[model samples]
Target chain A: MQINSSMKKSFLFKSLVDYLYILNVGGFLLLLTTISFGFVEINVIKGGDEHWSLLAISISCISVLTCIVFLRGVYYLRKMARHLLTHKYFSKQIIKCLKISGTHFLLAGVMFVVIMILGWIGKLREGLFEFVYDINLMVPLFLMIIGLFFMIQSEALLVAKNFKEENELTV
Target chain B: MPIIINLDVMLAKRKIRSKELSERIGITTSNLSILKSGKAKAIRFSTLEAICKALECQPKDILEYRDS
Candidate 1:
């Protein structure tokens, strides 16, 4: 069967979605690796054993949660895009993915404040290790909080609008 | 299977070029092609009206029903 131009445009959009998901996957992997590195280094710190354990535990938790979100998010997006190509252009699965990813962003925001307080304490003390979270972390955390909310609201709006209701006639 | 666009017949009778019709109708030639090929699922009333007005024709002049 011959394909139409509109189908071609739709495929292009799917490819874009695939590329974005690949980026998300790569970012998640990078985060995991970075956190593991920190975890290992923290375990090796002298006179900061307890603090290191706490930081390691928190970073590991964040990494695990982020990976779960990233994997599920990409899975849903890929499936949703394939379904859209065969049929129409909307998905509840995609909306769910957005919700999970948005929550991940919110966690990242909170992680920032925790790191900030620890970094300030480290700075005021002498002979502390070079593993302190920077005070400037709060600004970026605030930004991440804003970003997280944006994601949450945008997805919520899309799900609420439910373009399928507006576009496709019921069978 | 139900739509048969008579765009060619209307255009020929009116001596209008596809490019000119598209410009007047504010649609791309590619979209006009879709209409002409009867591949479009639907056309907006505004766009149908534009085509009729530009070609000095009626909706019946541009659209037909073909039993599948």
Candidate 2:
């Protein structure tokens, strides 16, 4: 069959999703390899104090969990993109994927906040108050907002699906 | 739903097949089936008028309301 304009657009969007998936996986692998090879040192506290070491380990664990959550979210997003590519716009799979991905992002955001708080407390104990001025803290805030946006988008899509069903069923 | 479609009964009473009625009313058989099976959320006035004309019956003949 001949392709239409909408199909072309969907194909373009699918390609974009493919790029995002590749970039996410590649960046994650690169980060892991760099960290494991001692190329990028993640030293949170110097002198190796017991309490600071515990805080560092906890922060590292939370960061890894956040990364895993982000990866899972991207996986579900890939699934949703595949469904859209096949023109299954209102499929239940899309809604389910959206919900799963949204939850993952929200969880990642919460984990990030926990990591920041732990790091903040650690720094306060070390008498370093300059950590609060770090501009990198906006990342978790943006993640939370994006997560809520995805959740709301899924709800809006659900409403649109209901309307489509009602229109189709009307005889 | 409390509002039920009785298109099947009307079709049977008129001795018309679902396919024939759908063709006559310019609608698909699946849509006609939805109406017959009471799965339709709502019916348009134009479609109801077309169905009424095709079956030669009043609107009440094909639609009935009942308390849940």
Candidate 3:
């Protein structure tokens, strides 16, 4: 079908699942780097002191955990898609995860923007530099945030339905 | 809020089995049962349309309106 990529038949959930999985693993790596090397390097390269380093570490922890949760949700989504006629506990989990991850991505985006602004403003206060980021980098982040919102909405709709369909099928 | 699905009535009138209707409608027998039992929360326009077409009736033939 022309809409396969946009439909459940094409297993679109795999994309979100992949994103969450990557985020989890990448976050863990970042956490490791921050602890093992970035801690030392940031002070030299970015002029970010130990406090910034610690905050980076904390955010990494939060993101890694969130990504893991979202990835677990991915498993449930795939399961539900494959078993359209079964109403089980895992189905409920999929819906719950959709709601959580949807909100999670949006929140993460907001937090990122806030932290970037604060980081820039903090630099401005020091009179050392101004915030000068290429527009390209910021565009993707905003687009990603918007995509997460729509994904969450659409996935949640799929989850809410079919209980009745499953019920009919089972009976 | 009181939209009654008249699938049962139509099936009774036609002397058809749920399994037969499901087969015709391309759904599992259990799901057809669920629809007949009024346990379904929502039905797709396509599925409902198929049922209506197969039964040779309008949606109102299978779905009724009442003040709830």
lDDT by residue (A1-171, candidate 1, tens digit) is: 245776887688779879878887887778668866885343422335555555455555654664564456455556556665774434555555555555555555555555555454544454664554567655546646754764776576586656445443211
True contacts kept of each: 0.00, 1.00, 0.19
Sort by lDDT, top down from the best: 2, 1, 3
Give the candidate number with the greatest lDDT: 2
Q: How do the candidates rank by DockQ, highest first?
A: 2, 3, 1
Tens-digit lDDT string for candidate 2 (A1-171): 445877888788778878887998899899999999989966666545434477788888888888889888878877887887778878889988988888888888888889888877877888887556565688888888888888888988899999999988877
Model 2, runs deviating above 4 Å: A1-13, A26-42, A47-52, A132-135
The reply for model 1, stretches above 4 Å from the true place, is: A1-87, A122-171, B1-68
- The CAPRI class of candidate 1 is incorrect
**Chain B TM-score, all predictions listed:** 0.94, 0.95, 0.88
lDDT of 1: 0.65
In the predicted model 2, the residue pairs found to clash are none
lDDT of 2 by residue, B1-68 (tens): 89988887888889999889889999998888888888889899999999999888999998899999
List clash counts for every candidate, in order: 0, 0, 6
DockQ of the candidate models in sequence: 0.03, 0.86, 0.16
lDDT of 3 by residue, A39-157 (tens): 74434225456455544555455545545544454444444444432324235554555555555455555555555555555556567686476884574387357548646665756
Over 4 Å off, model 3: A1-27, A30-34, A37-40, A44-94, A135-140, A155-171, B1-68
